[model samples]
Target: MTCIADANVLFSLLVEGHVAHEVARGWWDEQPDGAVGTCLLTRLAVLRLLTNRVAMNGTPVTPTEALGAWGRLGNDPRSVHVEAEPAIHESRFISLVSGRESTPNLWTDAWLAALAMSLDYEITTFDRGFKSFRGLRLRLLSMADK
Candidate 1:
């Protein structure tokens, strides 16, 4: 089975280290070979986080070091896929999630959720906010409520 990952999950693995990282890794390992997938937004978010860290520290994180973690995870023998699409239809997803109500923040989360829905993929996230959407399968990190 293919799973779509959220930026938080990827960031936790890249920056925070362990816990969620291991959990996500385990989940990915359990999926059918070559079934793990991430969207372009997730990658951009990770890069932004790394860049912000560099800016705050007054030093850049080398591309090698910044991508080391992702490379390791992505290179796993298990099936993994990364979506390269840059944009997704926001209004279509917003309408599906909130009906006529105005939705807040039309970013990666909505796009990821919409893409997952369109492709019949499960979401791996710790964000409780995702619970509000209907028809999306979620595998929340175990520590999410703690």
Candidate 2:
């Protein structure tokens, strides 16, 4: 089965070194070659994070290293494909968050959810916001779940 990974999952694998990392790693290990996919937003989100780090905290990750990481992720034989459609289904995301009072702005989660729906791939994330998005199959990973 193919899975669309969220940015948080990728971030954990790349920087946080949290349980999500192990979960993603294990999921990758189990997938057949080229069976793991992600949305283009995921790639943009990672780049944004790296950019923010450099701009704000002055964390010194060279552009070459960042590009190498991105390339490695894309070249993985287990990666099914990376969907880059931004105009996919997104209205449902706006509607879902419009009524929530306590929910923080999670635009990336919305995009990821919509992409998972469009691609018919289960979502792999650690964020609980995904739990509220019905019809999009999700696999939320925790330390205990891992």
Superpose all Cα atoms of candidate 2 onto the true structure and report the RMSD in Å to 1 decimal: 3.3
lDDT per residue as tens, model 1, 1-146: 67887777766666544356676655554677666677667777766666565432555466676687567767866536564433454554765556434456444566787878777788888787777667888878766433
Q: What is the lDDT of residue 138 in candidate 1?
A: 88
TM per candidate comes to: 0.70, 0.77
Q: Please, what is the whole-model Cα lDDT of each candidate in the order they appear?
A: 0.66, 0.70
For model 2 the TM-score comes to: 0.77
Top of the candidates by TM-score:
2
Worst 10 residues of 2 by lDDT: 51-60
Candidate 1: where is the Cα deviation over 4 Å? 16-19, 54-60, 82-94, 97-106, 144-146
Per-candidate clashes come to: 5, 2
Weakest 10 consecutive residues of candidate 1 by summed lDDT: 83-92
